[model samples]
Target: MKGMASYSSSHGRLAMAGNLALFCLILELASVGLAHADELRVGYYSSSCPSVEDVVRNTVTNAVARDPGMPAALIRLHFHDCFVRGCDASVLLDSTPGNPAEKDSPTNNPSLNGFDVIDEAKSTLESQCPQVVSCADIVAFAARESVRIAGGFYYPVPAGRRDGLVSKESEVNQNLPMAFFNVKQLEDNFARKGFSLEDMVTLSGAHTIGDSHCSAFSNRLYNFKNTTNASDPSMDQTYVSDLKSKCPAPGSGQDPTVSLDPVTPRTLDNQYYVNVKSHRGLLSSDQALMNRADTARMVLANINSGSMWLHKFADAMVRMGKIEVLTGTQGQIRKSCRIIN
Candidate 1:
């Protein structure tokens, strides 16, 4: 309890609520019609790898301590992995000869940076519980732990996911939503994965903590559909000016990074809703939430309610983690997260 107090003080207004509130928020998520498959269970590692959670927690904690941005990267890693091959950790594999992996994809290469941390956890797990914990489950658990480390609500991450044997660069674009996608595109993408449109909006809130490259959004700033205005009319003019100063028109030979949430960008919370509502979302895909009345309403709800969005976010994550997961004997538990074993 005292340690949590120390963390709360150090993090400073992340989630902007106490641990008790976060706990209650997660409790409320269960009754909110959120659902996932029965294949994975919270205690999946209770007998096979009892220390799985602790090992991962320690690995992620140490990594974040060294690099505060690691939490966001870990969460992003989870998202990328799940979107492609159902949280099977196919995204973590290195590209082989004539077989480029997901990590090498232009959308992922030079952007994703939490593989070492996952490897560290996998290595420790292999020593203590070899061939027991799967890399897929490790990625899922790391994201859950990252949310807590970044001062968001703690959610239960069901385990039992098996590491996938396949990873392809070609699969990245089809599976992951693009930065230039419209609301309809995003809706269909998450919908095909069995997520409601509201869940799509909720999951987009993960953008609240991470940083994005200028390349991802320069089109919105410089050339939005070849319109007479030369920029997205929906975006706030002041924010556009600020972004232009940092991004420098895209062809200046530099790809500087900007925080996804200018307000408490390092912290995981509902401020992403605040940013989108204010028309300051970094990506067109993110700001597109306001394009539809239905999606906009969910954003407002997330901002107005006290940690209700965070609660719903946990629920969304649970469902997202189960996206076509391979369990039981479906896949092998890779000895190394970077290669099939």
Candidate 2:
């Protein structure tokens, strides 16, 4: 059998030979496939969804104006969507009577917001272009808009992703990096998505403007070790005292939230790394960056060099938006983002 391949900057100019049997086998084994770099390009919607950028920008801008936290929420929404089902917008699926979707997963549930914003964008697109736009692309675009609105670096988002059909609750935990993940676990989780250690640390900077529920980090604040009444030793005592007030006690309130970077909670800057350097990273996973020599180096470098960090982060986000995307008839563009057609 003969197989053809092409090169593109985003996909690193990959070419395959032989029957292409090996490639298919690998994708099947991993349960995910990389998007053909040529399939998605910077101006993919120039003709199809010409107004996509304006529509998304206006929608996100208005939403952010009403609630400043919306940008961070949109950014995290994109992350959760890509992590679960390969940037297919599966995270937007609503739970049906018999089949609970990713949105209902405990890992996601109340923590992941911005669904209404996405739904609104999809609705506007449908009104203008009908089925021309994909929920997956809207998500990627919204994330870029979110960062730009948050005073962070801006980068182009390649388009042409299609909405995925599957959204199982069970798959969420298997793919997402957990709040309690140790350094190795953190590295492994991102590695599965074809991300590097640097990508993990740089992308983790998104925590700069977001907040976490008390339950996400309550374990670190109380009975951290196996011993009773023990707290995580790596955390600063003063920070722990502040967290304790917000969190109160274990099982007290799961929904009360605290900023990931209390110093600059509303800004997307190097303060997140600065907090990690000070032993003030909110989640165990955030603190875990300091535990590894390699990640620790990245954390400090990001702190000392703001411009470099912003550039690396923008590059990383672009790479992330390409994960296992569907194109050229691989998946469908749903009329409504919350349900499969």
Highest TM-score scorer: 2
User: TM-score for every candidate vs. truth?
Assistant: 0.87, 0.90
Report the C-alpha lDDT of model 2 over 1-341, residue by residue, as the tens digit: 12333334323433344337677788675564543545788888899779998999999999999888998899899999988878899999999988999999998888889999989998999999999999999999999999898855688998988899999999999999999999899999999899998999999998999889898888887887766877889999999999888886775545598999999887888899999999999999998999989999999999999888888888888888888788888879999999989
Clashing pairs in 1: 82-87
Residue-wise C-alpha lDDT for candidate 1, range 214-332, written one tens digit per residue: 98988888878875438888899999998888987756899989999999988988899999999998898989998899999989998997388878888888888887788777879
lDDT of each: 0.88, 0.88
**Which residue pairs show collisions in model 2?**
none
Please give the RMSD to the true structure for each candidate, in Å. Answer: 16.4, 8.1
Clashes of 2: 0
